[model samples]
Target: MDMSMVWRQWLTRHDRVRDALPAVPLIVIAVAATAVGNSAWHEPHWDKVVWTALSCVPLVVRSRWPLQVALFTLAGDLTLMTVVSHTSPTPAACLVAVYTLALLGDRRTAWIVGFVAAVTIAGVYSATHADSVVGGAGLVRFDFALGATVLGRTVRSRRDNLAAAKARAERAERTREEEARRRVTEERVRIARDLHDIVAHHITLVNAQAGVAHHLMRDNPEQAYQALAHIKDNSRAALDELRATVGLLRQPDDTPGSRAPVPRLSDLDNLADGFRASGLDVRVTRTGTPSPVASSTELTAYRIVQEALTNTHKHGSATRAAVVVDYGAKGLRVTVTDDGRPGVPKGAGTGHGLIGMHERAAAVGGTVSAGPRAEGGFQVVAELPISPRSRLTPA
Candidate 1:
């Protein structure tokens, strides 16, 4: 798009064009200087001008073969110096070659080549002209060569540092993106577990109530009406809870603080009454003095109880169930047991309900165990932390 950008792209694609362009100005300067200077024979030396121009020609491929180019340029400079018997044209071509070698070649090789070039140029210049070494001409040439090498090395180091910094920034960005995705997946799983527990519990009660109403439609009209009323109440409750659970997907700013409160340990009494209304004799008891706990822990405990009871209703022949809550210094423990004869086979329904319970407890740094008692009943016990210490990973 931009003219400068287009020029840069063209230069990058054409290596010879880029490299040869710089040498053009240096060649012009060297030839002009040599042609104008007075020679040892009191005339212009066209041979010195030719040699100087030839020395700068090798600079076109300095990047491709740095050491060989540097040596060739130095030899040209030496020949010109010997023929002129006076101060030679400023060795611009040799300086450029040494800079390229330092920038592209290894440090050890650059140092060795730079040292030899400097010593040979300085020694030859001092030998040719009287008092040139003492007059500082030799030292000036030596400094120019070494200074170009140092400048090239410094530029190379800066480019390397920039590349490394960019790489680190890219890696950090990728890590942040991965962490955000992981949190989103975890939130989705949590919502799914909540929906499973809510729908399964209330639907089971409604089904049982509908059956009772159907069986007693003619023989017991009054009880039939009562059973139908229970069904209506349960269906309404299910819808309310379902709406709340699904509302988690809404934008946070849409209806701040409008979502239903999460169920807590104190709500166990109402939960038990719902089971009682569904024809199950339910009892709830608390042992230690209840103390405040984390909201996550309370939610986990509630879900564990709800899932255990739902499984018992759907798969067990249990009519009597008990819920126990014990508050200890470290955490809260919940236990649910039912005295039901084995109604469904051992591996009855898809065991997702039990799995949900386990996941909920483990998320809050807790553990859950559910099994049939030796005395012919099913039991679920969960130990939840007051403040979650560490979350357990699910298998």
Candidate 2:
């Protein structure tokens, strides 16, 4: 109902222009024919006046039924030639009709229709023409016939061009859509992989702790309570990170009642705390100036840290882990390294943990490389570009 809304609707929909073809050519032909008819006759009366009027009827369904219109025009011209022998603008109408038919039909059909109209017009002029049909009437009968044929073909050609343009536009749109969908799908897979790496580790920890509790409950009550506490903390941390990682699927601006917030660069601290509570000795450090980056980039950074910590918890047989967040003018760098020992019982080398870290880093124009430290343990290094967050947030 609103003007802007209507404009938006039209802008989004491309079919309107293509569908208006029937009216444009028909209107032009009508106006031209009327001018030519009046100029040719001194008086208001002419046999073609009736024929011309009849031509108007076919325009109603010109686009929906081009073939039928072409046939009707041909028949109308012939009937006019017979009935209004003394007053037909036989040359003009014949050619115009040919052009119309050609425009509305396919290349081959248009040609055939044009040829028929040409021949029919030429025959009528040659045999039953007025004494003044050509020389006195200044009638270029063949030219008119040919012109009409050409007009129909040209309209059809233009229509084809328009259709092709539409197709290309549609194809471009489809490609954009598919590309977006693919990226989202990839993000989902990355989330799944992160959940696998992080939550799986915690679940593993929970299972391990549960076993320790069961074994120690009979032998030592205090040790059993500590192990049970570890399981609870680990389980809760797993739930929180899982919620944040999967929250990407949610619509951020969804109407009113929605599920969760889309995690941004700001959510990195929460991510860190969850890992810390999961029984990893994770100390987050920062240096240099931090620039704002896109939401996508922020999410990547968060996931990288999260995955890195999960790796440490899973594989590090050592006790402490450190994360250095460096914000430079051009980009951000995160180095997550542990002395490869969680003080706990497990080791962290094999799985999608590192793979997920690399993916998240690469997504935001960053790189991740992880391996056993030359000194003793494992280290993961990631660097990402910082696109100012202010530029990315919606106004």
Candidate 3:
């Protein structure tokens, strides 16, 4: 859209038009100077005009064959000086050719050609004009040739630097895009784990309570009503937790309090009560003074406990389970043990529950170990740092 950029684009699309631009002015100046000189001498110099035009015409292709064009123009200049005894002070066409060579050719070749052109032109002009080698027209023409070479090299360097900078910008943009995609993938995995834990835990309890209500309905109507009430409570709890978990995907600009509060260690008692309602005896004990921790660390600790108890309720033949929490100087240690026979084989079912617990622990720089106890039960123990070096924010 910029005017200068548009002009450059037009020029680039028409190579012959761009290349012929330099020749137009060079031809005009040389022909005009030749006519003026001939008029002053009271004679016609048609040969000088023709040769000058001939020399300037090769500039149209200077970019394509710079060395050949330079040589051709040099021959024309030498011919006008030696054979015709007519010399132009400027030698415009020859200088243009040398500049084109330096601009397009390799550095070594450009310097070699430039040096030869300067010395040869200056030497021949000096010899024909009988001028001093150091302080004369010859020296001035030599300087002009050197100046053209330097100018051409400078332009070439600037172009190369611009090209490199453009490449670096493009690469940086691609890196940012890849990083964004990686973060999105990590967030999706975290969300999936949360949804699984929420749905699985509540659904397992609902199934247990529904069976109790069905069996008691025929003979014990009052107990059946209690079982149905527990089912209603659990289903409602499941819906509320599901809404909170899915609310994590809400827009960031939404009010912070719009989403439900995430679970923490303080909610462990309520979590145990939920299991106890499903006919699993659960007890929780704490040692040492509880200290505040990062929200992410607390969430990790809570999820690990919830997942451990869910597994015990669904798979273990345990009537009683004990949860122990120790707030030590180094970190927080949580242990859940059940006095039940391990009904499920090792590496059983989908295995997502155990895997999710381990992942949550690791995300907060902690560890989880679950196995059958040597004394005859199953236990899940987790050790979590009080202040993790890094943690994944809950989505």
Best by lDDT: 1
Residues 206-310 of candidate 2 have per-residue lDDT tens digits of 776787788889899998998888778877767765666555566777443332355565666665655554455677888997767667666677767767666
The lDDT, on a scale of 0 to 1, for candidate 2 is 0.65
Taking the tens digit of each residue's C-alpha lDDT, what string does model 1 give over 256-347?
A: 46566778888888888888888888899999978989888888888888888888888888889999999999889999999987544434
C-alpha local distance difference test of each model: 0.83, 0.65, 0.81
RMSD of each: 3.6, 11.0, 3.4
Candidate 3, residues 130-183, lDDT tens digits: the string is 776675688988888788888888988998999999999999999999989988
Cand. 3 TM to true fold = 0.84
Best by TM-score: 1
Scanning candidate 2 in windows of ten residues, the lowest lDDT window is 386-395
Worst ten in a row by lDDT for model 1: 35-44
Off by over 4 Å in 3: 1-17, 38-46, 49-85, 315-319, 339-343, 346-348, 371-378
After superposition, which runs of candidate 1 have C-alpha atoms over 4 Å from their true positions? 38-50, 83-87, 130-135, 218-221, 342-346, 390-395
